[model samples]
Target: MKNTVCLIAAASFLCSCGGITERPIGVIYTNAADPIAATASGGSRTGTAEATSYLGLVAVGDSSIEAAKKNGGITSVSSVDTHRKNILGVVTTYTTTVKGN
Candidate 1:
């Protein structure tokens, strides 16, 4: 019975270690133009569209960051908008993992 309990506790601890954790590395903001200009043979017309901006919270394990640096720099980024209220516009939390060469 004691042996079984110890084995169960060890398994539980190992499982917990793989659980998700948040670690903020950096933040980024992006501004993009909407309603691209249209051109015709007669002339061209440009219409101003409302500017959209976003804030991203980048996070990754410390080991992942070190591995990524070896490749060069950040190659790809994936983000999702939660539309949370914060000092930054349209606050969003992001989870990212790095890929190394």
Candidate 2:
């Protein structure tokens, strides 16, 4: 019984995988010389967008900058970040976040 339980645990561990992944898509350097430019020094604001898909086939939607902008309520951004949460590589949640003034 002990050996059987150990084998099952090993199999389950090998078969299951889940975690969070983050990626940077772009970055902007804010300069004091340009008022219109996105500056790194300012009130920090964040916008997040989410996308959902099934089996990597049929997809409902995807995260976009426009969505992020709407969420964050900002005109420009200094940097963009992405995150993915997956369950058994079947269902995935894609997220996009932006930071700026």
Candidate 3:
């Protein structure tokens, strides 16, 4: 019985030490043109689409965000304009880990 308890405790300690916490990645931004100007500015439309794509991949109000903040990660917030006259904003945070050579 004692041996089993000792083994369990050791395993728990090892698991705790081996855990890796989730971290933030980065923020993204995009800008689009007004309906009348979109036709004139292809670049703006593209930028707006790019920003939308990036925002789609972000997870907001997740526990990971809190964890990253607690771990000293960098946070960024941005705004994007869409071709449809819509504006979107998002905030992202990132945590970095360095592997030894």
Q: Pick the candidate with the highest lDDT.
A: 2
lDDT of residue 18 for candidate 2: 25
Q: Determine the C-alpha RMSD for candidate 2 after optimal superposition of all C-alphas.
A: 11.6
Give per-model TM-scores.
Answer: 0.19, 0.55, 0.19
Task: Give the TM-score (vs. native) of candidate 1.
Answer: 0.19
Residue 77, candidate 2: C-alpha displacement in angstroms = 0.4
Clashes of 2: 1
lDDT of 3: 0.30
TM-score of 3: 0.19
Q: What would the per-residue lDDT of candidate 2 be over residues 1-101, giving only the tens digit for each residue?
A: 99999998876555422222132211121111112234566547888787887776866765886788778986768777666565644676677776776
Per-residue lDDT tens digits of candidate 1, residues 1-101? 99999999887654523343332211233222122122232212111111122433443232233343333353332211111122333553222223222
Write out the backbone clash pairs for model 1.
Answer: none
lDDT of 1 at 56: 32
Model 2 worst lDDT window (10 residues): 25-34
Model 1: lDDT to the true structure: 0.31
